[model samples]
Target: MISLANSAARRSLRTVSQVRTLSSGIDIDVDHYSSGWNIDDIGEFTAKTGKYQIKTFNKISEKGLARFNPEKFEIMGSDWDSTNANAILLRSHKLQESEIDVSVRAIARCGAGTNNVPVARCSELGIPVFNTPGANANAVKELVLCGMLLGSRRIVDGVNHMKDLGAQGLAKERVEKDKSMFGGQEIKGKTLAVIGLGHIGASTARDAAALGMDIVGYDPGLSIDSALKLPNEIDLTDSIASAVANADYISINIPYIKGENGTHGIIGKNVISSFKPNAVLLNFARGELVDSEAMKEFLDNGDGRYVSDFPDDLLWDHKNAVILPHLGASTEEAEDAAAAMAADTISDYLQTGTIVNSVNFPAVSLPARPDGAIRMSVINKNQPGVLASITDVFAKAKLNIVQQINQSRGDVAYNVLDIDPTANHEAISMKDLQKELTMTDGVLSSRVVFGTPGCGYARNIDGQYWV
Candidate 1:
């Protein structure tokens, strides 16, 4: 029977084995094992078997679409109905729960947030949803800087005034006289409170620090690595109220989750009431994160400024508000990087069952499939004895496990098992093995992958409820 140790112990064993394999110089591709299989090899394998259909929404960058090997992937745009697609890639398109087809194994959003995708529903269906977190950090960071300037200075109003003057044919005469009317305070020496402290938040804080701004940050979920990367000048605060209490500017960089305890209206009356009277609030994250009614009251009651990329009906014509069309990640560089990351993420998950940057599933990865061995991926409910039941199936079939790894997140558990069929006492049918595995109690899905001599690699079996 296969040993079902804890996930941490299994990961440690896998690490030691990898180190030993590296020292032995066994001609194994360690990079491919750690990262993923080469696109060319996947293309070659799919060319002989069948291609994976990728249904794309919105205008995905051509640079990103190129990452998928044309021979192995069929890209379907808006013009085509791709209900049989193996995966979905999109940006800004609000994906409905009903729109997710049964054939889809994964969903990828080109940008950082998965709000546009039906993440909870996808999770229940055993579908992993991916998002590029730091892919557009630089773009959003630069835009946040612009938002700060717009909030502190009268740049937007000044430009509009100039257009009005030019239309009246008094541009040169009124330029000098009207300059003082658009005067505002400099951002230098100002205090900036950054909420969330994720990729975009950290980047914005770093750049703002370079501009001589005092940074105060608040994030309860901050990781050790992320905290270590923060600037030494930043003051860590315990709560949102304390962080923005005395700050000159406040930046909201958190995500928008919809639930009772979620961040849907994180910036409500209590949080807004604690803000400094003349403080400028910047939000490039999500509109739903802030309470619209509370924010409107805050703006109307004081001289504070509200600058955001997301537009709101109530705040659209507010004198203290500066709204811009959502352009946080609209740069060419950001779009290309996001698309490439999304494409590569989808390819790795679909071809090798290696998931990294997944928003809905736990991070799970395994080494390259050894020669003469087949790899099996199983998704099941996280419960006691689930692993035992899985291994019992292999034991009954007389299959020998070469290596295995398992990980869990919340209600879901994922297992990757490498079995050596040659070492089995009796021959087993691949189809029957998969069917039995899928029929196991609590099992959500199962997939089998093996390499062919002439072909690179192929998935011969898949058992999901939708399938």
Candidate 2:
């Protein structure tokens, strides 16, 4: 087995030398060669052998699709069978667990929320689900401002009334007399309670403060970075009740996770009952985060208004409810940003095993591979000795480790190892190494990426090559 491995390694090294000689003139300086090589070079080389198959669902922005180099990827439309896809990029398409095939390495949602995708199932399969958080934050924040104005000023009502009067040919006289009916308080001095101090919430709070609205924020899970972005004058509260108790306007910008302990139906009777009289409630977030029944009762009992980007059957015709067609992130700029972010994220992961902004996986990034090194990525259940066992495989094969990075999130762990063979050591068979790693207990999947020219990439799943 060792002799056969050495023969294959020698052949691979010869192919690498031949390709380099053909691409660049002989006697190239090592420093210049090292400086010039980049991820794009690997991508272009891989393109000649096999391009990564990317399946896109829904209408991804052209700007985002263009981020994928046509030389390195074959982008498929929604009609294509996703069974052989190396990755998926989507926007709001409801993806099922069954649709995730063995060939899939990652899933990138163009927008913030992964509610439309089966995240937990993908996590269990060792798949990192990427979300473009804050990519659409500005868009949603602008719409929240619109919702607040629409709720406070009764602009929709006035417009409808004006249309009716115009049809009756009495617009001039009636407009002056009835304009007072649409009169409402300005948001200048009103207090706003912002729930979930994430990207959108923080952006909303900063803008609202600039508009002279006092801000009260509630987010128990607020990170240091998010808190730093908040306005200094904004008040931070520990609980939802205290935040909305005295505020005239409340906005929910949290994610919707669907479990008893999750954010599903988070806004219930207790929170609604504590709302100040005539308060405006805005939910530009997921509809499921608020209890429809509780919101309906709140609307029925008071002069308060409900404004939402998502439409609900219960509040569809409510006199005090203003529902939009989920247009929070509908702007062209937001779409382009989100699609581009997703494309870049997936590309980075596929080419270099760098993960950022992943919802289910820990953020892990390693420096560029050393010259003539092979990169190996392993996904496994987060358990004791998994890392040790992985290193043991390399030790037995006598592969010199150049660099490594490992991170765990929840039940899964991701490992990336860079291996370079020394002059005295023989190269281990990459296929055998992948088989051994995947066969190891607790391992979910394993992939080997060759930095050596002409070798391309291979993964244990489906035993297919992805250049």
Candidate 3:
């Protein structure tokens, strides 16, 4: 009457495969996608699925695939798009409704634009999330350089003028001639002020250093040691105004954001006016870092020219400006590179379950302990005496804590505790812990990870994690 033996075995294997952490640091999921996604393999993921995906652009709809099956596999690269946003919310909603074990990989996160994927939701679900930082450093660097050159040389404008006006000595020469009317200043000997020199800023600095331009980056967070290593000693400034003042061109590379925005505009009319009148502005970074209204006003006054990859909606009444539709890193090569980084990040995560660049999740990698530790990730409401009470419960169970990492993501607090299950009065598996933790008043949920590729967990401002 009961047909649950072999079917259940097959289902379980399909749902959750047994994974063992090996010496190579690859965490092989028993229920993995396929053998093609090997732990050590990087080029294959790109060579097979990604090349066409990135080149064709929107041909392979990972967004649709994610919507249909939220728990099937990790989404490694979701920077923007309406579909991506919906898919992100869909995944979060699914995770919040039940106890879900998940992994995520997001690269080029928090650089610019506020249309981020559902990062906050991952934290709430206790879903272990990972991201790759500085994966697009080269692309971003080249973008900055290109924007600066385009703005300074007025290449686009000069070309437009040539077409509009007839060329030659009689005609053709005239076209090539009088180009200096819009021809701009040479980049050499001009000073450049860079803001927020992480990976992008550092690369931009090296390129600018080769151009014989004096470099001064403004960031309260940067170290003097990092400044000194950039071929030439980049004069460092602590204040934003100090970086902008007197500089021929100001290139912003800050990862700043505001107003529920991780990467929105930071430069306003005030910041715009701070630079010298003839100074050009280049923003291939995050769009929100520059205020559209201020930019419109600045352009109206002919104070400067602005060149950016920001979308049209990001622009106000602007003139003397070139907007490239937020395509700073939209190159084919950049796509392949980003895809490889993202795929590898997800691949590593699906197996051994490590987080290299987690935006919402904690950065710690909870490796399996040699002493056979059972790790418990407990999510509970933010209030008093919850931790103590939970400790009492564990103490009553005669459990000994090995290593614990606790952090509060907004109102909810998460505790990742590694305990020796043998130290308990009796052995307690994840099922027992889950049931017990769920019944507790403040505990949203508790999970026991076998140290398979888990995100460690992700977080957001929403109250969904409490459910």
Candidate 4:
């Protein structure tokens, strides 16, 4: 009878282990830093896709998408809307490989540059960087034109007056400023100067033309052929000043950068002072592209009507200037597109490591683990015996190690360990493991995660739904 009971107990344990392994599909990383989306959206693609174990924030040490099964899973980009996504990928991560297959749709953060994301990092890591550059070009370009027209026409004044407490203030001012400012100048048939012919600039020029505004494009990067599609009466100038000098309204579409020579003040104080008296200035680009103080002084004291969407102190606190909290691509269409595109990228990376928009690492397509064990990503000192220390903790816990991957960062080591525990133990119970890791002389930080395939990221969309 005792022998029979032992046999039954062994079978039960095996069944539990099998269920745990069978339940292994993909582990999506959940955190506040990520936009809400997960691998569950790509269920039809991976039929053999394992059980998805929900991973916690502190469990994974690799930031952004690196925590997603770093070993077997290769994160990369692809034409998500076109491809059969049998893999998972992530957005907002640096891809580390080259000559990779990808499905990527990337739109910049409304006039943002590939500037902050270095190409060398992607090239060295063997990853390809492709962007959906013109994806939302029309939408943003239209907004820029609208901003310019409004700046020229002072439409913000109308919007502001409705919010004001003074009765009849708007009615009184509308009749007064319309004929008063610039002797009643309208945006129609006026010059619209654009500083960049990149995606947004391209859009701005095209749309501004429709509104009967003459376009003046000044970009050192754009060729004459590309500039030809601009307004028929538009002017193309080599100098930045040539664009600003003859404009009834100015739009700075340059990417934002910090530092003295970092294009922070491309529209310098000197350039601003040279503007036509009462010339309208609008910046729908990065905040650092223009000189905030000079612009404030120019608008507040000079003869100009300033309207912008940037969050500069001068723009927000001043009356003439209109400030928006970086809502260029905040439209429902843009948000939905971004969310879907980012999701597809993350899902692809999770399954195949095909990193399309990654800043580092090559794009790859592979599983995180073969045996379907819990994936733990650790970022720590790369010194000798660090791996031994981590493995020993699992050894002490009497867990079975299935696979381990360690990527070195200079002197630090990022380790991904897949393990089978002896019993049901919450990975967070590894506080002792965390303490032991922090206590290690060389260990920087330790984390654990469930490996799905792509970037593991999450947020409470409906809020309180996770409960």
Candidate 5:
């Protein structure tokens, strides 16, 4: 079972402001961030969706809430109604199986992991999930340094040992006599194996190199941007086994992709057996990435230690386990950046049908359509002729296609169409058109909207709920 922090239960749906005009308004529900981010920018951009309303929870950042233009949109208190909420902006609050709302067209998480949000269920519901991937890179990188230091040196043990002395009579003498027991090697000149050279991994390698630690890294999924961010001195490893075998310390920075062929127990028997006898293993990633049974067996047989932010029952209270509360992305700056990014991405999706950092859908962003043009967004099963069938409905309605784009992610596909009836504007009825599009086989959800160029929000009132 996956367990989150105690703060996860504080489920809050925050910020929404409604416009007084008769135009269709999008209701954006804001929630509490761990450190409370500045999302006034989100409110401002979302206002482009003609008349819009923002509903915020009591825990919303005061500075962010104040950014909303009070003259344009109605701001309500915590008792505000959210039945019409178009989206959810959140941080750590978990959206479990039965809690997923049908009205929410999308969910934008302030941080990287979507574990708190049921991503698979969102995909099934055809609701996009957005996350700020590198927004907390620096915060996690610094924490990696902290974990490495704690693992290599007996700093925590030393501090605990000193605290036990209590400055009693002759305490200084007692401390001086027992200091050697807490002694461990310094990090300088030690080899550090960094698995998953993504944002956090690359940053950690660069900083660790500056501190004189030799860096060995491996990441099959490393992007070009991440590769450019790495220090030139790092030795690129051919495999995890090779990297772990050669390092004095190992840092696992990969995300947990559940059920991937080699994911579950990625740091299993082979890697654990090859570790330097007294080496330190750090897992700031996910708990399921490491095989707890193998880790327990390894630690029981040697002087090695394991440091992890996500600890299961096997690692809890173990002599060599240095378990930490998941504090990698807990810094104030990280929280603010993540929340701001998440808000911006979500606003972009709602106003323009452009998805940038969506976890469930492939990234797609199109140029703004001309004024008075209608737009259609369809989420359907990934299969042949799904696009043609959607376009056929538009063609039969005698709509001129201004621009169209289609993208697929795994088993689902998202299509966007910009239509202009030109002289036949009276012939195209949006209400009837949406009905026809939704009736198409393989179509999960469809929305038809018209207004200013970036003023239309996709309203999915008939979204399928997956429990």
Candidate 6:
């Protein structure tokens, strides 16, 4: 709950490259060189920690930079270098293979859509990437309403047509005469089909319902909690075809992850063919969710109007398209909320071995250890004997387990353990323990965190503490 707005001007945002290795431990890379906006909550969280180092490029926001006290945390200003960055606090900037250093342990994006992040590659590297899902739900919901309004009224085209009318004598008369040509229908009585009922999708459905729009949603993976939270009037449809076929407008809110039964082009030929003629399609989600070429064909056929938050080369400036610069989660409040959540999530994981919102690994939050205890978090391939190997290593080292929690998702499993590190117990080398786990058959990554909730250093013991 630390506020950075009070002292934003004290820290200037400029392009510079520098490196400062504090403890060769947890060095965080703050995306300052991307010319993207930063949030103060992340800096405030880091500042309060007083344990880690944060490296920044030019993109670091004034408030975010201002909150960093040298005495509390090490802050490095750099020009686009992430070589020594172990953890990354990122926003819109893309995290490609070249930009990622082997030192990176985790990457936390400030917003929900992780399309800007290379999630699959990170998973392969056994690095858990995180996102703030519902933190910006309100922001995206408001924008979806805007999109609905824009589609129903044809405001984008109408405004352009109005601007084209020169300010000559009798221009007002001409506008009045031509106004009816741009007139469109209202959304109150219309049906809106929402796909992928995640946080933003469900929020959009509820808000649109309050505006008198009938909601029809389709999401095979919708959780029971999310389902219960949805408005009662919303009719949950069984299939995408059913949702898209009967609606006057459709919103694609699903993630664009490509895998086994993947959503690479979920809104392609089948969904488009079944849509009601003149149905408006709103996609505030990833651009890849809908196939650009297929969507353009549908738009060119004059069957429906397409509005996208993410515009690609194929659909840019199309007469039937209203393209936005990915503003779904761009509000000031959303930026702060998401950044704060991401910072807090990463801080919790690094300091206390807690995984809350990781995309690759299962969420595991264990109770805080006592005064003197050693904590460890392990991410390994989900297979037999992995946990046994981990515990056996601890047993061999004579480390007493104080408390532990374990969870698994698909192919990966997450383990958090707090051990008694008293002088009377055997002196266990965290490095040797990590090496043992890494050498095990299915083990992917292992980390040992020293200290408790208020202070700790998460280090990879396979090699140097930083790596």
Best by TM-score: 2
Clashes of each: 0, 0, 29, 68, 13, 11
Count residue pairs with overlapping backbones in model 4: 68
Ordered list by lDDT, greatest first: 2, 1, 5, 6, 3, 4
**Overall lDDT per candidate, in order of appearance:** 0.77, 0.79, 0.54, 0.51, 0.70, 0.69
| Runs of candidate 1 exceeding 4 Å displacement | 1-49, 451-467
* Residue 354 error, candidate 1, Å: 0.8
- How many clashing pairs does model 6 include? 11
* lDDT for each residue of candidate 5 in 1-467, tens digit (9 for 90 to 100): 11122322212223322222212232211111111112223222222233334433324334333443444334443354333345666666766644333335677777788888888878877889888999899988898899988887777778877777775555587877888887788999999999999989999999999999999999988899999999899999789999988799999988887764757788999889899889899898888999999999999999899999875887888877789989888877787777667656756676678989888899997888766566678898899988899899888877778989999999889998887666453433454566567767778776544432222222222342110
Q: Taking the tens digit of each residue's C-alpha lDDT, what string does model 4 give over 301-354?
A: 765876666677657867667777766765655544543444445445344333
- Off by more than 4 A, model 3: 1-114, 118-130, 162-173, 223-232, 260-265, 313-319, 343-355, 381-384, 391-393, 407-412, 423-429, 451-467
Model 6, residue 265: distance off in Å is 2.3
Worst 10 residues of 4 by lDDT: 458-467
Candidate 6: tens digits of C-alpha lDDT, residues 344-427: 776667666788889878888678776556567777778898899889887776767888888988777888887664532333
Residues 194-295 of candidate 3 have per-residue lDDT tens digits of: 887766787788789899899888777765654554646688877878888878888888765556745465677667778787788888776768878877
Number of the candidate with higher TM-score, 3 or 6: 6
Give candidate 6 regions above 4 Å deviation: 1-50, 56-72, 75-82, 167-170, 423-445, 451-467
Task: Give candidate 1's whole-model lDDT.
Answer: 0.77
Best model per lDDT: 2
Candidate 6 local lDDT, residue 20: 21
Flag the better candidate by lDDT, 2 or 4. 2
TM-score for each prediction?
0.85, 0.86, 0.67, 0.51, 0.81, 0.79
